[model samples]
Target: MDDIGEYIAKESIRYAELIVSKLFSAADILETYPRRGTIVPQFMDESIRQLMVDNYRIVYQLAAGDKVNILTVHHGKRLISNTRHFKKKK
Candidate 1:
């Protein structure tokens, strides 16, 4: 029982670290290769695209002056109800 508890704790910490690292890497990729992600067909917008990092989706858009505007970052399991307005982030 003790060994099982220790393993669970370690796994939890590792998973958390993985998520943080993945998020950082995704941000870096977006900065370096803004148009690397494919367009999200559901929206039917060429400027909008999504990059999948693990189970999360990094949604962004090509703003004026060829700048990549990060819209939102959320888990894939959740539904994106309103894609119209998202708080812009650099």
Candidate 2:
């Protein structure tokens, strides 16, 4: 995530900041908009869904009691199979 910020900062500092803000905003939206993302069938987990933010994909899951668990934020071009092993950092 820090790498993504650095890459975008090279283009424009404001744009980079905005991108990070949008990422957080997307997460907030998920709290109230859980079904906004579509199911990712490759994982065969219906709870897993992805929300798009520009060229990125904010992958998350719906846990028990409707809690939102953000799994990862990845580039849209990457294959879901490659990210299937991701475990959220503590």
The estimated TM-scores of all candidates read 0.72, 0.81
For model 1 the local lDDT of residue 60 reads: 83
lDDT for each residue of candidate 2 in 2-88, tens digit (9 for 90 to 100): 777889999999988998889889889987778889887666567788888999888888877778888878788988764534433
Model 1 alpha-carbon drift over 4 Å, by segment: 1-11, 86-90
lDDT of 2: 0.80
Leading candidate by lDDT:
2
Pairs of colliding residues, candidate 1 = none
| lDDT minimum window of 10 residues, candidate 1 | 1-10
Output the lDDT of residue 41, model 1.
Answer: 61
Name the best candidate (by TM-score): 2
lDDT of 1 by residue, 1-90 (tens): 233234445769666666767766887887777888888666767888888878777778888776787777777777766545642335
